[model samples]
Target: METKKYPIIVEQFHFDMVDPKTDTNQNVQVAMRQVEPSDPARKDELKSGNMFEIMVPFDVIPPQAGFRVSGKITRVVQTLDYFGQANEISPDDLEKLSRPLIEYIETLTYQVTAVALDKGYQLEFEASGNQKDNQ
Candidate 1:
């Protein structure tokens, strides 16, 4: 029997989601946003209750059963500008820019997928951590 788990794949990119009127990125338009550390460690700009909200795009469920759903970062590039001139990026800066994304990916351990089945789906999930603490 095929079982379903939380199939929601949430992939996030750090970007400033604001009205173009306020702050525009006309010069360097990127698919992903720049992740910055907040003053208070717990207060992440991507988290709720912040000036800029991180927009996550994912389907409610997968298209077919037994199909693999992936959340991967295809490309991460950084560019630095100096004296009205821009360069590709240095290895050090590239690593720095990709640090947060790398950390986020490390936390994934098949915990975020939620299967949508008629019943008995709960029993198939691996319950170890505070999975019951929040929900």
Candidate 2:
């Protein structure tokens, strides 16, 4: 089988799903999100909740890192300055756009900034982190 490996994969789960006879002791898996090397990192401004913005490569079943969130860009927000120059969304707006999907996205980025939103709300990416361990 040709299996591909990723730096991280995140899965959502439901602890409330109980099958009367099939299963009751397990939390049902609900949703899953995956990120390839194209994934972005957590922003420096948002790194206060992280350890030096080094998001790890791992998976979360229930998405625990979402108590507040790590950092990942789901939406790109653009703003304008007084000079008509383009500007990044204020921290307030960044948080506003990121808060809801933090669980799903941060899980993919692993709170690292290798891939993240930039000053223009565009995705800032580092080189692809995919590596071939089998080789």
lDDT of each: 0.27, 0.26
- True lDDT of residue 13, candidate 2: 20
Q: Per-residue CA lDDT of candidate 1, range 24-128, in tens?
A: 111211123343335677444323321211222211112222222224432322232211111333445434443443334323312333422222111111112
Q: What is the lDDT of candidate 1?
A: 0.27
TM-score of each: 0.25, 0.20
Model 1 TM-score is 0.25
- Segments in model 1 whose C-alpha atoms lie over 4 Å from true places: 1-69, 73-87, 110-135
Clashing pairs in 1: 5-114, 5-115, 6-113, 6-114, 6-115, 7-114, 14-33, 15-33
Q: What is the C-alpha RMSD of each candidate to the true structure, in Å?
A: 17.9, 18.4
Cα lDDT, model 2, residue 87: 27
Candidate 2: stretches off by over 4 Å: 1-58, 63-73, 82-90, 103-135
Tens-digit per-residue lDDT, 1-135, candidate 2: 112222332333212212334321211121222222223563432222211111222222222111212222232222222112112224453333334344444333332322332211111221232211110
